[model samples]
Target: MTVAVLFALFTVLLIVGVPIAFAMGLSAVTVVLMFMNVPLVLLPQRFFSSLDSFPLMAIPLFILAGNLMNVSGITAAIVRFASALIGHIRGGLAQVNIATSLMFSGISGSAAADVAAVGSMLLPAMKKEGYKPEWSAVITAASAILGPILPPSLLMVLYGAMTGQSIGTLFLAGILPGLVIALFLMALTWWKADTIGGQKHSRATKAEIGRAFLAALPALVLPVLIIGGIQSGVFTATEAGVLAVVYALLYGFVTGKLGPGLAWHHLRDAAIATSSILIILGGAALFSWIIAREGFPAQIAEALTTLTSNPYLALGLIVVALLILGMFVETISALILVTPMLAPIGAAYGIDPIHFAIVTIISVLLGSITPPVAIILILACRIGGVDYAKVIRPFIPYFLIILAGLVVITYVPAVTLAVPRLFAGYGG
Candidate 1:
């Protein structure tokens, strides 16, 4: 009865267009008021408690680091480097688009930021190179999802905090899966190069490649600093975020790309973005608390186990459910809401938490390109000036490629676990 009431009210609120945080808060409160004897004060308590973790401090810092990097002109450097490396391909700009996203993913940790920074810069160039606007938008949106799948990922931090998994292991786990997805996207771009018909350049000269790599080397080293610092026991994940911000500030100042005014503006923007995410998280935390109190996670695990004792079958069902849920819910909201319920179930099926974390992140991220709430896709379309309807058709192939990569990551734990095991000697 409590679960039904909570979910029913949540559905009604979503349909009525209340903001997600408030919708979750109201639903949880309403259920508690009517059915449970819990004090209303517990709602506020849970909200504060949810945001109290040290690991969660990484969220705002990473957002700020991404914003600072954008203002500091690091993105242009990375793009130039990517272009030098891959611009000779048949679909030159399209290949560069994927490569740049793969590089930018290390810094931004947010797909929306990836689309805004990379898409805004590359989509116009792609159009001028005679690529279709819809295809340009599709590639930009599709590749940007890699941002959250790579190290320094915001979703991975949230997952770690919620599941009590190591953030370092999650970061390490994402490395290969992200590369696999990037390779798949690049392969698709290469295969369709003739159909896309973009201007191709000669392979970059050795001197040209060296110059671009040197220019972008500062930006390129950020992922190593973050992942390496954490894995080497030099800092905690939260401390790594501090290092990221300090590094971004120093780099921006030295490069002269970020003046006081621009720095202040970017800081304010990061604050607003962080506040929005944390609010959703606080509400989802309360909602999760209510669900857990009712033994909902165990019940879900039991029900899923009854349906299929096969671990592979259980994974398939969870992936399908996540993809479906991703279309409706915001990715962070979905992550916070589902991780608590599903992680335990996944464990019961003998799934590695690290493997499950990568699968869950990738699965939810696919929604950023799908319809209704395709945030990354919408950003790309708006930037590229392409019709959303036109881009969806071109988006299908890339989506399938990414979906195939997700399946490989799901079934082959080594794809997600190898790096972590190699570095830390612990798979989970």
Candidate 2:
């Protein structure tokens, strides 16, 4: 009864267009007042405790680091390096789009940031080079999904804080899966190059390549500094985030890209972004507590196991559900609302939490490109001056490519776990 009311009211609030955080808080409070005997004070208390986590400090720090890098002109350097290596391919600019996102993903772990930073720069160039606006926007949106799947990912940090899993292990686990998605996008770009009709550049000379690499080398070393430090036990994920900020600031100053005025502006922007995410998190945490108190996780686990004892089949169902949910809910909101419910079910079926974490994060990310709530896609389209409807047709093939990659990551544990095993001697 409590479970039904909880979801029923929550769904109603969503349909009525209440903000996600408010809907979660209101639904949880209503469920408590009417169905459970729990004190109302628990709601606010749980909300506060949820935001009190030290691991969560990584989200804002990573956000700030990514922003600092963007303001410091690191993104242009990475793009130049990627172009030198692959800009002569059939779909040269398209390939560069994928490669730059892959490189940028290491620094900025937000898909929206990826689209804004890379898409804004590349979209106009692609259009001027004879590529259709829709194709340019579609490719930009598709490649940006790589942002959250790479190491130093904000999504991975949030998943770790919520599930009590090792953030370092999760970061390590993300490497291959992120690369797999990038490869798929690149393959699709290569095959569709002639159809898309983009300008191709001359192959970069050794001198040009060397120069670009030299320019990007400092930015390229950030992921190593972060992942290496974490894997070597030199810092926790939260401390690594602090280091990332310090590194970004130092690099900015050394390069003369960030002056005091620019630094202050970026810092202010980061704080605003951080505040938005933390509020959603706090509300979701309270909702999570209410669900847990009602034994929802155990019920969900029992129900799923009864439906199918096979872990693969169970995961397939979850993938389908997440894809659908992704179309409606914001990714982080969906993660907070669903992870607590699904993690237990995965465990019951003998799935490793880290493996499940990788799958879950990717699934929600797919939502960022899908319709109705395709925030990243919308941003790309707006930037490219293309209609959202026009981009949909071109987006279908890229979407399938990413979906296939997600399936491979889901079924082949090694794709997600090998790096973690190699680095930490733990395979999840």
Q: What would the per-residue lDDT of candidate 2 be over residues 109-158, giving only the tens digit for each residue?
A: 98999999999899988898999889999999999999999988999998
Q: Please give the distance, in angstroms, between residue 13's alpha carbon in candidate 2 and its true position after superposition.
A: 1.5
Which digits, one per residue and each the tens of the lDDT, describe model 1 over residues 1-428?
89988999999999999999999989998888899997788888999998988998898899999989987889999999999998997679999999999999999999999999999899988888899889999999999999999989999999999888999999999999999999999999999988776897899999999999998897899999999999899999999999988999999999998888988888888888889988988889889998999999899889988998999999999999999999988888888889988998888888888898899999999975788788889889999998888887888898899999999999999999899999989835
Clashes of each: 0, 0
Candidate 1 residues lying further than 4 Å off, grouped into runs, are: none
Q: Model-by-model lDDT, in order?
A: 0.91, 0.90
TM-score, each model?
0.98, 0.98
Query: Distance (Å) between predicted and true CA of 383, model 2?
Result: 1.1
Candidate 1, TM-score vs. the true structure?
A: 0.98
